[model samples]
Target chain A: MSLAHKGLPFDRNRVSFKEIPKLENGYSAKVPIIRDEDKLIADSFAIALYLEDRYPDRPSLFKGEGGRAMARFVEGWSQMIIHPFINVVILMPVHDLLDTPNQAYFRESREKIFGRTLEDVAATRDAKREAFTASLEPIRKTLLSQPFIGGESPLFADYIVFGAFQWVRVLTSYKLFDAGDPVQDWFERCLDLHGGVAREIKAAA
Target chain B: MSLAHKGLPFDRNRVSFKEIPKLENGYSAKVPIIRDEDKLIADSFAIALYLEDRYPDRPSLFKGEGGRAMARFVEGWSQMIIHPFINVVILMPVHDLLDTPNQAYFRESREKIFGRTLEDVAATRDAKREAFTASLEPIRKTLLSQPFIGGESPLFADYIVFGAFQWVRVLTSYKLFDAGDPVQDWFERCLDLHGGVAREIKAAA
Candidate 1:
């Protein structure tokens, strides 16, 4: 979304869970490794900082130093708060969507990480759903005050969080939020941006 | 904390739950209401913005518009996320710290808000501790990457969160974070700032 926001066109290099990228000198097993001509950057936050610094004339990912820091906090919130909860809620659906080998790898890895079978995780999600939604209070409340996490306009912070919602939306038909939820409203607004690239994705039927 | 960061001196006017101040023109009853010369501002975020706009030459709380928006998100996180969790942990202790009449007001208000007695709330703290700490993962993870939520230097974002911690700290001997946690480290670092004003506050024995 930040890349799209910058209007920077690039070739898609979507890799699976087991595929590790061979860098010029070494290897990084991350999906978000970006190669900007000669420069290579790994990690989303670092990539955001690199893009902001490299393309000073383009639309900014961060407004300033303080913005950059707060965006990092948002990134942390997404990783720690949003992604974990979303992952549990949509685990089995996501597995079914993947190729057989990738599905096995996904189940094995997630089970190892969570210490529970995919079925077990899914079974408990019903009990945990209320707490999970309650955890979104910050984002919901933030959206109540502003249109986007990036103030009036969208920035990297919006993308970081939206990515979490998109992750779940593309895999499951399960409703994480109720009708008329402010968060659901913001998610819709996010999906509507950049020619609706996020909304255009094929989800589980 | 932002006030101290900006080198502004303030006369503290402590108000309890029942004490609502009568303003000159109208009555807006909230704490942290600052009388800045002829202008009176209520709420911490509004006050920060007013101070930043009013005292342009002073140290900035937010670096730019993005920072301001992100700080508001942090404020929402503190209010919605941190405050509620901490309130559960320290409600009884907080009541113990208040004056007799104020304690009655605090208990009555909190009971109404939470739909439970203060003792009942505190009783569940033991079981809720793990989930509460898990919620702090965002702050912990962010601090792992950066010194403060506002980045290298303390900004209003840091104060927004630190205020939540400080609120619980001054009223209770109950330790929220385990020793060696990154959030605990950041809280200590915050205490070390502004000439340790946060650290200097006397906790309830």
Candidate 2:
């Protein structure tokens, strides 16, 4: 979304490993690798921050101390709580919980690492949802009174939280969040700013 | 320590329930609060970033994209992995997970709401550590070449990682990290910069 918002004229390709012919110099099995000029940056945060710094005039992703702190807090919170919860609850269940051949490797990996049965993993999905809701309460309270998490303008914090919320909304039956009037309004404003790739990504998903 | 490095007259006070008698009105019950003039801020990262922003001339706590990204990554990573792990492994074991008097009430409420047990919480901790180590291997490999995670100077990433590592080093016997040569050198550099606040914090612990 940050890339799309940059408004740069570059070739955007959505290629999958199975679709491409195998070759000696074939790309590694990594998604969303951005090749800007000579730099090939991996990792979403790295790419986003790099783009924000490179194109300062596009929009202020990180603004004041309050905004920056909120941004960092939300980014960390989502990565820690929201993303993992969504993965365990929605992705793992739909894709691998029933122990299909394609998911055999993942099942084995989960057992080796976590010492948990498929049922045990599935059972914790509700707890994950609860923890996620608990963590978001403070942020939601703040957002309910203000337009954005940082107040007034949508900053990097909104993007990070929006990404995680969007993932959960698309993937799960959980409807734990009610950002309320101010937050809902701010979210609409954010959509106006960086909704292009976000919508596209969701549509593809 | 950032305050101390700035030659500011700031006093460190350890506050607890028992120490309420010793603390003044405004300073009471705030376990990890910092007072600078009329401003008071809670949370470690918030304080660290605030100090850096307030005292820009002391030394660059966080710098360019590489530095900032590395710092943010470590900060996010610590909150994602270490913070929750600490809650389960150390805090729960010590019977002081939430640091509130309403533990029984909270436990009852949680049980009623989510039906989660201590064992379930512990399992999440183990899972988090496994996932963290798996994700961190790439970061560890990246640190092999550079004297710091970002290179040369000890960026805020070093401090962020150090803060969480301190907790892990003290609380658990999990050998998930080794400083190695480059990381060790960078660690030393960070210690020297802030008059060894990282060292002091660990020592105090």
Candidate 3:
């Protein structure tokens, strides 16, 4: 979305967790590693800063320095608040979509990290769903006052959050927001951005 | 903290929920309403904006337009994320500090809003405490990477979050953080700001 917002087009490269790409900086793993000719950048936040600095004439991922800091705050909020909840909700479904070996790798890694089976994590989703929805209150309230978290149009902050929802959308049919929710309206607005790039993706059943 | 950051000093007025002062805009309630000679501003956020624009020469509460927008994001996060959790933990203790009449008003109003007695809310603190701490992960992670949410010295974003912790501090000695927690270090640093204005306040206990 940040790349799209900046009107930069690039070929998509899909590297599964099972495969590691050898890159400079001695870092071989991470989905968001972007190779701009000889420049290799990893981490979404770092990439955002790189893009903003490298493409100064393009539409900004961050509006300015302050926006940059606040975007980091939102990134933190998404990491701590939104991602964990969504991860639990979609864990089993995501594993189901992986190949047999990939599924085994996913389960083993996740179970070691969580100290619980993926099935057990999915089992708690029904009980935990309300907390997940309630966690979105900050975003819901912000959308009430502004058209976007970026104020008038979608900014990097919007993409920071929308990425999580997009992940959930691709892997699960779960509806995280209720009808008439302000957040639902904003989510629809996000999906509609960049000529419906996100909207065109089909959900996994 | 923001007012101090701007190097502004003025009188302090304490109004209980029971008493409201009438003003020019026919808006009478809410604490933190500041009177700048002839101007009256309600709401901490509005006051911050007003101060920034009105006194641009002073130390900035927000660094720039992007900072302003991000500060609002922090404000939203504080309102929805921190305030609600802190409110639940300190509700009973806060009620305990009120005088007889005010205590009656507090209990009646809160019970009606929460749909439960104050005791019931307090009872859940043991179970809810972990979630409250978990919610601070964003702030904790940010503090790990930056000295302040504003990047260096404290900014309005820092105050937006610190205000909630300040509330918790004055009302209860509940020890919200474990020893050596990053958040605890930040909280201590916040207290030490503005010549320790927040630190000097006496706890209700």
Q: lDDT of candidate 1 vs native?
A: 0.82
User: Model 2, residue B191: what's the lDDT?
Assistant: 62
Tell me the tens digit of each residue's lDDT in model 3 across A1-205: 7778888887777656676544445475766888788888888888888899999999887776667777777888999888888889789888987899889989999999889999998898789878878878788777766788877777888888898988888888888887788888888899999999888887667
Give me the TM-scores for chain A across all models, comma-separated. Answer: 0.91, 0.68, 0.94
Candidate 1: clashing pairs of residues: none
Which prediction has the highest TM-score against the true structure?
A: 1
Cα lDDT for residue B12, candidate 1: 76
- lDDT for position B106 in model 1: 87
Which residue pairs clash in candidate 2? Answer: none
Candidate that scores best on DockQ = 1
Give candidate 1 misplaced runs (Cα > 4 Å): A21-26, B23-26
Select the stronger candidate by TM-score from 1 and 2: 1
Instruction: At residue A81, give the lDDT of candidate 2.
Output: 58
Give the Å error, residue A23, model 1: 7.3
Order of candidate numbers by DockQ, starting with the best: 1, 3, 2
Residue A146 Cα positional deviation in candidate 2, in Å, after optimal superposition? 8.2
- In candidate 3, position A24 carries an lDDT of 47
